[model samples]
Target: MISRGSIVVMAIGGALLIISIAHHSQEWMRVASRLGPIISVILDGGLAISLISAGWWLRKQQTTLTPDE
Candidate 1:
């Protein structure tokens, strides 16, 4: 079974990935650039990797979940 913390982390990572992609694709930087697009790309990639890793870890722990063993 997956831990609650993993679920929350996955959710957060997913949101971050979405936001990063949106910011990267948007041309708002040309109008009024603040943080630049590079940061978004980096963040998006990082978040996606983290989410995948967490999911893998959760899957690996699936057989260890039990109340009374």
Candidate 2:
């Protein structure tokens, strides 16, 4: 089973990823430009990696908790 904390973290990470991508659009670039490309890359990549890792961890935990039968 996935923990509530993991769910929350995934949600937050998903939201951040969406925001970062949306901000990359031409119209949204004006706002995203404030953070600049480098910072945005780091922020987005970090969030994506964290979310993926969390999900992988949760999956591993879930499998471990289940009975082989």
Candidate 3:
């Protein structure tokens, strides 16, 4: 039941999640030393989960709106 837009949204979310993790990891190692390890992990995890969930939710909505065969 997934639509094209939902697929695109999920792809975008996945890409963003990857990029954000990389960026945050580097920052945590080089600049966020004071924040320590756990904070960065938690922050990135939250972001990625939210993004993926949003895409999934969007897909669900799109499927619901369509007329069933």
Which candidate should be chosen as best, given lDDT against the real structure?
3
Off by over 4 Å in 1: 27-43, 62-69
How does residue 39 of candidate 2 score in lDDT? 72
C-alpha lDDT values of all predictions: 0.71, 0.69, 0.75
Q: Write the per-residue lDDT of candidate 3 for residues 1-69, one digit (tens) a residue.
A: 677887777787788778777877777678736575457667776777687888899888887795759
Q: For model 1, what is the C-alpha lDDT against the true structure?
A: 0.71
lDDT for each residue of candidate 1 in 1-69, tens digit (9 for 90 to 100)? 556776776777778788777877674456476465666687676878688678667756765777776
| Per-residue lDDT over 1-69 for candidate 2, one digit per residue giving the tens place of the 0 to 100 score | 556776676777778777766765533455645557657667776877789678668757866895669
Worst 10 residues of 3 by lDDT: 32-41
Between prediction 1 and prediction 3, the one with superior TM-score is 3
Positional deviation of 65 in candidate 3, in angstroms?
4.3
Clash tally for model 1: 0
TM-scores for all candidates: the values are 0.54, 0.52, 0.64
What are the clashing pairs of model 2? none
What TM-score quantifies how close candidate 1 is to the native fold? 0.54
Q: Output the better candidate (2/3) by TM-score.
A: 3
